[model samples]
Target: MNTVTPPKERAAAPETAPASRRSLLKRPRQLWAVTGPLVIFVVMLAIVAGLTPTFLGSNGLTFIAAAAAPILLLALGQALVLNIGSIDLSNAAIAVLGAILLAFLLAPLAAAAPLLVLLIVTLFGAVNGLLVAYAQVPSFALTLGTLGIFQAAALVLSGSTTVYVSANGEAISALYQSGILGIPMTFWIGVVLAIVLWAGLRFTRLGLAMTAIGNNESGAIFSAVRNRRVKVVVFALSGFTAGLASIAIIAQSGSASATGAGGDLLLPAITAAILGGTSISGGVANPINVIFGALTVALVPIATTAIGVDAQAQNLVYGLVIIVVVALTMARTRGAVVK
Candidate 1:
């Protein structure tokens, strides 16, 4: 009888749940993470456009696109290496080498020049892959060594002089200076390559495996990811991109110099990759952000000149911006798991 007593009223429910709807928002830091760089980029663009009216004009736009193409291509290569927790300092050197070959060796072949350059690039990439993947050398050391070797080769080939393509060298010039649909050909090539890489990274199994290896090699190995093979492929792709970039540079300048593209390109190329939201520690990559980053870096110098800033000051500012971006990215990624 007692047990049947109205199922013992559950001790009155502890305080009733609050009735007001609770709204949640992203943390302030997270908001800044996305908006800070975007705001700065927009502001910079506005300032440049205001000071150099040409910046908003077709000619200026074309110039920007042309200038950005090589770096964007090189940055894509760098981004690939970085994604695998490696670095390729030899990109500019490879580009310079390819330019020299194009001017001296392949130039005679005319229409076949691009194919020969592509072959050379593939070879260079293969070597890098073999050494890094098979020989077990640290990427930094290996690439640095190759950088010097490639530069020396370039110098020997160019003989302390610039190799000029005839102004009317239609085929060679087309690689760099020509365009399709009112856009520079080099620019178009870069856009296409970027799209391809972005798609590969997003839609392919190899891309997923590479990302997994980059994020954690040990974990990837445990999970049966073929790390070595993937890394080799990545290095090869980087080399191919560098080679293509070299051709573009040669076309733009209508010449190849012994110094190659010069070391001036190295920092900027790396900076673009780092600033593009690609992890330096290796993981996922953002090609769209990389494109924007390359454009921003290219525009800095253009804007500086248009605004009458000294070259030295421009370099200083560029360095500062890179450092700040890297620091911010590191802070956000530290102690956080990527996958």
Candidate 2:
């Protein structure tokens, strides 16, 4: 005897099949999210090793780590800004400005100069946060304006020339020249910072707020997350990291200039963040994998040079790599927007 089932139960029973199928289909994308960037990095290194044969040697590895260190630092800052649905075009500028300030203050401030520079940049970044949060300014336009402000300040301070760190150079130089446990200090600092930031994102209230806000601001607000405060802290962290990166730059070069590392590093830093699996659409970031992304970028120019590619061709390779990687890593969820 056929019995009439309740309408609610009948409707609910059919939903499970499609839901299970979706779950099955989603597993591959989830897996790709975790492993894809790493696979690309490994494959690139393998290709380079095949061409050079000596690319896997200790010296080659060390060079890659060292070169990637500063880029990683800059990428870390960029990732923090990106995670919250914002971008900081001024991070590299902040680095240059910090470097110049550190150099100028080293003689008088001595051991305290680095701290002071970090504080200044952090505060500068907070200002950016304030404008974006309270004043309702768009991050892109605000940061672009601040980028000019930072560059102008850098130029004025450095007299449009390189500011050499003759006094207290050792304090900054040790960050790049010295090592602990056979790893360069710059790389060590980057690794430590990455771990710390990763932990924050994985196990902290602030991190949760950032993720929620980025994914859906209205929903996050409904959840009682302090979206504006979290943004301020995020930008402050970005600024502090930029200052840290400036220290690495100054240490590596023994000087700071307006048109030096900062100007050249913005593109690579942003590329590293995106390639590291940070979604440009916001609400996604992987700090640890960002290290791999930085390594890949660091390897590019070297690989190109080793393969007899000219500088112009090397740039073309960078552009192509960015485009391909962005396409691969972009989060394509329903209703996702790139802006």
Candidate 3:
């Protein structure tokens, strides 16, 4: 009797290939990745520069930098999460919670408060990771449920009042106040963070695993990637970033509302990520592009105010701009595969 033959499984791509570096830097699609945001940035800048002669001037530029700071960090966190094929709906809520905790803790803990808040935030993210990775819960449902719980907890814990730490606007605002080369420290800090994230995502084995799983989970499993551990770390990084953003929010407002006032930033954060060439679906992230995307988004409101344009008009324009950026980036990614 003839025995039935089993089909052989296809092999996964080699994990240690040097093609990763070349693929990142030499991909023709990478050019579009940079150009799309840079072009949008320059165009909007020109329009705003023409509309208000001062928009691109020294102080006007500083204003944009300051405004973009916290939102940019939130976008950073969101971009990282999206890269891993997940979402963190509680990112802004966590920032608000961290701010409130920082305000109260800074009085007693001093500089250590930021550290403590980051730890707590990381733990919160660990919980999300555990549920999502081990329990197989849908990230959207998990994050959405956690969002409500965390937001309500923040409101209740802080009595729905704005908390102002005495030290909030002091050394914490140093970056917002000072600039090097006429560029605000806020923008510089964002650039530094972008570089750090880019390096982590490009040069590290952890980053390789994250991308592998994001792009193709079955392949990653076939390659023996530690999928669950990577998820936890990525989510933890997102939470840590959210905590860092709380410091920026405190510096900007000199206070934080318990009702999670900055929670509204979630939309703009997601917008900036998408605008930065990050795929909402998964498997794409460019922190450098995120910086440019952030700068462009930050300038819009400032531009409207400078030119005396109504918020309604600005919203209309903002929607159009975001649509254009997303479309261009998506097309670029698709074109790269086609080629």
Model 1 deviation from the true structure expressed as Cα RMSD, one decimal place: 9.8
Tens digits of per-residue lDDT for model 2, 1-339 = 012446975776667678756654677876677777788888888888888887667567677777888889999988988988899899889899998998888888888999999999999888888888998889999999999999999999999999888788887788777787555799888888988988998799988788888777888999999999999999988899888888888888888999886677888888888888887757888898788888888888877877667877888987787788768765567543335
What lDDT score belongs to each candidate, Candidate 1 first?
Answer: 0.75, 0.84, 0.78
Top lDDT model: 2
Using TM-score as the measure, which candidate wins? 2
Model 3 clash pairs?
A: none
Give each model a TM-score: 0.84, 0.89, 0.87
Clashes of 3: 0
Task: Show where candidate 3 strays beyond 4 Å.
Answer: 1-30, 167-169, 331-339
Candidate 3, overall lDDT? 0.78
Worst 10 residues of 1 by lDDT: 17-26
The best-first sequence of candidates by lDDT reads 2, 3, 1
The digit string of per-residue lDDT tens for model 3 on 216-238 reads 77788889999988888888887
Query: Model 2, poorest ten-residue lDDT window?
Result: 1-10
The alpha-carbon lDDT assigned to residue 127 of candidate 3 equals 84
